[model samples]
Target: MKGKISLDLTEGSWTASGGLTFTKASDGRTLRFTGAHGDLAQRSMLVDATVGDEATLPVDLSTYELDMTKITVTMPSVNSPGSVEGRPFSTTLKPDGAAVFSRAFGTSPVPTGSSLATLAGRVDVVPGLG
Candidate 1:
């Protein structure tokens, strides 16, 4: 079986119930998720970054403290429970490259409860010699 790598995140559900969790789904690569807050930030973070709209994300594989060629994600829903609004949401990676999804609906102030305004995405590391 192939190893998987990913990062997960959540909002509102931090103290009592909800929270984000980032893990390597496949042993493809190692990723990190750093946000403004611990909880209201990303509950879980992964590569395989997918968006729900047609947006463009900047790619620079020379700053993330890592190295890579391409970064893709599963398009996020603009109108969903944990979707984000606005087009072109970006991320700053380390050692290598970065990516972002736009028109998200979960990038706003989170509400209170186990359920929160969520923004989920992923990043896929192009096969490379590690």
Candidate 2:
């Protein structure tokens, strides 16, 4: 998750550019996303990090001071013009450092509503790590 990013909560959008990688700690299988471009905002973030080998999943984002959760969401579709009770998530990612069907997914603690956003920039994503 090293690179540059711009967030616009008012617009409910975000953009990212950098390198991303997903590592499977159980077997040391790394899925790297190079020259990554991320998208996130509101309650949902779409990331298209290229997958590869040799990466680390046990990453500590707390050191970056960037909190993905508690992000401002102002979408009218969610039935809650604004709320921080939910976060973006992905239901995709294979056990072999790959994503299934679509490179898209959503997270848990769902607010039982609708959401969408972009986290622009290259980012490392570990399944179940967030």
TM-score of each: 0.17, 0.27
Error of 1 at 48 (Å): 23
Clashes of each: 59, 23
Candidate 2: tens digits of C-alpha lDDT, residues 3-109: 22233332233344566554555654444443322223323334444324323332111101134563543433434332232244333222222231122222222
The CA lDDT of each predicted structure is 0.27, 0.32
**Highest TM-score against the true fold, candidate:** 2
- lDDT per residue for candidate 1 within 36-130, as digits (tens), equals 22222332323322233224232221111111222233433444322222223333332212223111322222222222232333332233248
Off by over 4 Å in 2: 1-12, 25-27, 33-42, 53-130
- The local lDDT score (0 to 100) that residue 7 gets in candidate 1 is 24
lDDT of 1 at 92: 36
What is candidate 2's TM-score against the reference?
A: 0.27
